[model samples]
Target: MSTTFWIILAGAIATYLTRVGGHLVISRFENIHPRVEAGLNAVPAAVLTTLVAPAVLGAGPAEWAALVVTALVSLRGGLMSMFLAGAAVLIIARQFVG
Candidate 1:
């Protein structure tokens, strides 16, 4: 309808096609190469570090506390639980730190 709308629609379609194309290509391979598999396995951590590293540089005590809680919770809890715990700690810590 609008230029912004068309741009967003184009982006969405491109993202979906890229994802499906990757899956289709991977599925065609009977056995993945060890180096390729290792690179793929590292994707999650690399993505996570990219997301967190910039924030870490400017984070304050509340953020640090939340990060510590999140890390500790992640060791024993599922993703949802760890997220909730970290969110709760961040909220609580902000009250005092602020």
Candidate 2:
């Protein structure tokens, strides 16, 4: 195999092992404390914020407007709705602003 193939194979194996290891470790815990459970529940949101913050901070007015629309729509709708609303707003805003 080429070096690229070997690198991809190694990455796949590493990703699989980490996923399985996390599942195994988590499954062993019979009863999680309330605080720990709450923290775990917040992890997804925290991760999403961390991933999005930098882009949002560096974005232009149109992007910021889209984000505002996204937040408003998110309050009254599900994830898909929020995403669509944000995308539509961004597209429209970009046409006018950019």
TM-score of each predicted structure versus truth: 0.82, 0.75
lDDT of each: 0.95, 0.93
CA shift of 95, model 2, Å: 0.8
Pairs in clash, predicted candidate 2 = none
Q: What pairs collide in candidate 1?
A: none
Angstrom error at residue 98, model 1: 1.8
- Model 1 clashing-pair count: 0
Best by lDDT: 1
Candidate 1 lowest-lDDT run of ten: 18-27
Candidate 1 per-residue lDDT over residues 1-98, each given as its tens digit: 99999999999999999889878989899999999999989988999899999998899999999999999999999999999999999999999997
Steric collisions counted per model: 0, 0
Residue 38 Cα positional deviation in candidate 1, in Å, after optimal superposition: 1.6
